[model samples]
Target chain A: MSTVIDARDLTKEYKSTLALDAANFQIESGRIVGLIGPNGAGKTTALKAILGLTDFEGELSVLGMDPRHHRDRLMREVCFIADVAVLPRWMRVSEAIDFVEAVHPRFNRARCEHFLARTKLTPSQKVKQMSKGMIVQLHLALVMAIDARLLVLDEPTLGLDILYRKQFYQTLLEDYFDENKTIIVTTHQVEEIEHILTDLMFIRDGQIVLNTNMDDMGERFVELMTSAEHADAARALGPLDERHVFGKCVFLFDGVSREQLEPLGELRRPSVSDLFVATMKGTYE
Target chain B: MKTFSWLIKREFWEHRGSFFWAPVITACVMLALNLMGIITGEVFLRGHPSVMVDGTHLDMIGHYLTAEQLRQVGAGLDMSMLSVTGVLSTIMAIVVFFYCLGALYDDRRDRSILFWKSLPISDRDTVLSKVISATVLVPVITIVVGILAGLSMLVMVAITATFHGANLWTMLWTAPHPFQMIAHLLAMIPLIFLWALPTIGWLLLCSAAARSKPFLWALAVPVGAGIIVSWFSLMGVFNLSSTWFWQHIVARMLLSVFPGGWMAYDPSIFQHTESPMALYDSLSLGHMYASLVQPEFWVGAIAGIAMITLAIFMRGHRDDS
Candidate 1:
């Protein structure tokens, strides 16, 4: 697969604080990569650098073009929903569509209109008149209609209810995602998007802690649940994180084979959320 | 070109109130007042019972006046149309000033800048769109509205003249040089736009750079400079009078509408001409064009371009989020 985003030793500094510190990663096309990080973990900074919204020290390229220099040119194929409520509140739905159609060559107005037809959004409706869920739906409808190769969504569903959040991802997956497109998303609610993410990158303190495919996660990491008697044997294998559940020890091991772990205790694949917690905790430790 | 057009359209969309609606409302109010004034004047004349002249009462003034005296009255009426145009111009200037000051700052404050920046449009295009909207589009809209308001006022006066048995064409339209007056007013707008560049550019720069209170920021810097210049003058360093700063900078802000001092319009036109048409004729477009090569014009243009370029840079580099 061809790489859509390649960042080598990317560094961004805001005065004394290093927001992105030699961060290195490559995102190939046709993968839904979740950039998971806590607040101030440089997730937004990294995304900004990639989107050419900010300058950075190392080399970064999106779709074979240097984003810093060819930002306008690069934007032709890259669509982004930076955050919730980014659309101007005073803008009417029709004006918004007209604006995107005029400026973006890849935008399909008919497709956007088709998507909006399914929602409660009308052409005359202003953004401020819509609820948070409706706003997200409108934004999503606009974004999904663009035939962009890369779609970077930074906390796209940041402030929506569970129903809307579920609907957002469901609609995106059903209507927007295809094998030819690449999506990079960041959100606080990791569990909500974990099922759809083909790959995940865990970042902390401007550094990547974990970068692996979702399918490979089970082979590389294991959560072993065992009685107190077998807990010491499970711990000998150097689990990355340990916790107690219902009077039993549940140890999360990274890179330990399941065959070896199964003999000592019940081995199960760790959920993405659990893996993320383990990864972050390991970094702190 | 398409992107630039859309960018400009977006600007109008965002600032429709200040750019379009405010001037339209002003024109409507001015028209309404003109109609009210004409009706009140007619009612007062009828109630007071002026002497009859040719089947209509014109005894208070028109019947007794000589042809020359009537012409002078006509001139006065014509000059009032110019005054209306001036009032509309003043209103437009004020609207544009505040619009320039807030254009860049408002989007960033509301976090709408993120959405704008996400588009394929460059920062240069974005800043230029705001500049053109302020300098070109706003003035054009104001000019159109001003013309309509002027016409409405003249029509009301013409109707009043007919009621008084005075010749409508001679008393109102012909004396005012209605077409010439409008042409002159329309011609002045482009010049005013060029002349007001420095102020517009400074406001835009402040709008882009200020994190909060753009008004205070735009005001404080110039006032601070004036204060320091005054202190230096007190020390007898170079004999720099405060009026020099006021004339060169503060006065230049209003110079677009009121061209005086070095680039002054001929005061003789007001003194000599009884006809507003003659007043417009005496005013030389050549002098206005000559002022283009003057040091003040070039200095202001260069400074304006520098500030605008800096604004573009700030918009590109600053991450407001």
Candidate 2:
């Protein structure tokens, strides 16, 4: 697979504060990658750097084009929806759509109109009068209307309700999926996106603590719970980390196989959220 | 170029409420004022004074004036009323300035800048639209509205003057010089731009810096700064208001010219213009439109360009969210 995004020693500093440490990452062309991080973990900063919204120390490229040097060209192919409810206040829904249509060479007005219809927004409703969720939907409609190669959504569902959030991801999946397109989404709702993500990357303190595919992740990582008597033996299994929840000792193991772990109290597939919690709890060398 | 027009169209649409409402309201108010002046006869019959009693309070208070002097007084009143329309021009500037502030700030607050930046347009187009809006488009609209108001004022004054036996043909034919009016207007281009550039630039910068309620601080800070500057500048100068206006105009002209200090020109290009009261005598007939020919004007314009360039770079690099 070709690398759609490549970052080497990416570092961003604001005054005396370090916003992003020396971070290195690569994303292939066709995969839907989930960027999972806690609040203030530099997820937005990284995305902003990628969008050329700010200057950073390290070299980074999207589609083999340096965003710093060729931001306008790079932006033409890469669409971003940041804080999805921030559509301009004075713009009518139609005028905003027309603005996008006017400026973007690849913007498809028919597609944008169709998406607007699906969202139940009228062409003339002023953005300031719309509800917050409706604004996000409008923003999504605009972003999705563009024929972009890469879509970077930062907290796209931040203020949205469950239904709107579901619709958001559903529309993204149905309308935007293709071999030549890539979507990188960062959100706090990991469980909701676990099914859609082809690959998952967990970043903590500006470092990628976990990088693995969903299929291999299940085979390589297991969640094992043992009775108090067998907890010590379960701890001996080369687990990534263990935690006590609701009076039971649950452990996450990476090196041990299912056949070799049958002696533990219980073995089951760990949900991405559980794995995220386990990974976040421990010290990784 | 097509996209630039499209952008301007969007600006018009966004400001339709203000643009439509403000001028209409202003025209209505001005029409009413003109009508009031006509009916009262104070506007077109000024020198006539309704009576010629000057020796004593009540002795000739009821006495009337000669027909010829009354007509001359009417002519003078008509001219003064026509001059009153100049107030409408200033009103137009205020309304247009309000709209420009909203336009400049709205782009960043609503994430419209992101939408535009994502497209193929350069920052130069984005910034130039503001200059065009303030300098070209709004002024054109203002002038159109001003002409309409002036016509209305002229008609009312002529009818009222004729009622008092003044010659309507003379009032109409030998009216103020349209060329001189246009000349003063041409002179106002740099003055208007110079007076408003920093405010616009500051608003643009603040818009880029703000995430929410973009206009609040974006507007308040610059106005607050202007008030403070005006206050301090007013304190030191003897005839402080004139000096303050001159210095302010010069500074704005400087920003407009050098945007990023591409030239080191003095702001005196604008400073040398006569005050509005003295303009009739102090200004040469040709000098009203002569501002465009100055090297200092170009230098100030370059400074303005440089400032806008710096503002765009700052906005592009700054983290708003």
Candidate 3:
């Protein structure tokens, strides 16, 4: 796969806080990568840097162009849902469609209208008159219509209810995603997007801690549930984390072979939520 | 070229109420008031051998005047037709001021700047759209509305004169005053744009930079400077003059957005207008073109261009907002 974004020593500082501290990562086209992190962990900062909405010191390239200098040109091939409530309250739905069509050469007006028609939003409806869910629907309709090579979504479904969140991802996957495009998303509701993500990244304190594709992750990480007798043995084997559930013990291991882990007890692939909890165990403190 | 036009259209869409409907409504109100005044005057002069039939303005005053005096009356009549514009332009000044104060700040306040930035449009284009809206679109709409109102009033007078058995209808079609007024107002647009840029640039800078209350910031800077200048001059701290600061700096920063606001500083306009007819004769396109060459005008215009450039940079770099 060709690289979509490549950054080496990407850094950003806001006064006393180093929001992104020499972070480095490479993303390939045709992958849905989830950049997961806790609050204030530089996920949004990194997205801003990539979008050229913020300045930083480092070498960064998106779609083979430096976003810092070519933001307007870069935007021709890149689309983003920066925030759901960001659509101006004074704008009408038709005006929003018309503006994007006028300014964005890649925008497909018919496609936007098709998506908008599925919703209850009318052409004359103003953004302020819509509910939070309806706003995201409108935003998604707008972004999905653009034939962009890259799509960045920062907390795209932040305040939405479960139904809206599930529907958002479903629509994105079915209508917007393609092998020709790359998607980078960050959200606190990691579990909702877990199943759709092809790759995972865990960041903390402006540093990327984990970067691996889903298949590599499955091969490198395993969780084992053992009886009381096997708990010590599991710990002796140096599992990354160990915990007790009822009278039984569960141990999570990183890069420990499945063949070696199988003889101890029942083994299953860990859920992304479990991995995230285990990985970010001490972040709050 | 197309993108620039769309960018301007976007601005018009957002501010049509103030930029368009405000002037239209003001002109309509002026016409209504003028119509009411004429009907009331007709009622009061009923059966009194009204001046309307007695060959009005000339017959009553012509017997007591010279040829030069009669020509002055004609100029006065020409000038009076455009008097309603003076009121509308004042209202236009307030509308444009508040619009500029909110132009950049409102998007940041509501976080819609993020949405706007998500498009391919650059900060330069976005800022230029607003600048053009304040300088060009506002003046054009207001001028058109003023002309429409003046024409309607002129027609009403012709009809009223005809009803009184006078052939003012022919005079109405023949009068060059309405066309002259339209040409004068149109010529003033470029002057308005040049003089208004300083205030528009100042307010836009405050709008893009102020965390809150841009109007207060825009106001406080110039007024505060004036106050400090006065206090310093009182103490003889420097060789500063307070009146010069208020007249040259503070007034231009606050009042330069008005149509012909630059002429307010020109003593010639008031000194010669001691006779009403001379006001029309003295204020011409040539007089306006002359104001363009003044050192003060170019200095203010250059400073405005600098502020506008700075505002563009600030809008792009202000990430916290």
Best by lDDT: 3
Write the candidate numbers in order of decreasing DockQ: 3, 1, 2
C-alpha lDDT of residue A63 in model 2 = 90
lDDT of 2: 0.68
For residues B1-321, what per-residue lDDT tens digits would candidate 1 score against the true structure? 878888889889988888888888988888888777666766765656563321223443445667756654555544556666667777877887788888888888888787787778888999999888888888778877877777777677666666666655665545546676678667776677667778888888999999899999888887777677776664255566776776677655433433223345333435547855566445545555655667777787678888889999998887767
Give TM-scores of the second chain, every candidate: 0.82, 0.63, 0.91
The whole-model lDDT of each prediction reads: 0.80, 0.68, 0.85
What are the clashing pairs of model 1? none
Question: Mind giving the per-residue lDDT tens digits that candidate 3 earns over B29-147?
Answer: 88888788778878897655544421245234424545665455446545556676777788889988998899899999988888888899898998989999899988888888888
Fnat of candidate 2 is 0.61
| Total clashes in model 1, counting residue pairs 3 or more apart in sequence or in different chains | 0
Better of 1 and 2 by TM-score: 1
Better of 2 and 3 by TM-score: 3
Q: lDDT by residue for model 2 over A1-285, one digit each (tens)?
A: 799999999998877777789888999988999999877677888888888777888899889888876787788899988776567777888888878888889999999988888777898899889987898889888888899999998888988789999998999999977888999999999999999999998888777778787898888888888778888887776788888888898888886888878886788889999888777764343
When 1 and 2 are scored with lDDT, the better candidate is: 1
TM-scores for every predicted model: 0.92, 0.79, 0.95
DockQ of each: 0.78, 0.41, 0.81
Candidate 1 residue-wise lDDT at A23: 93
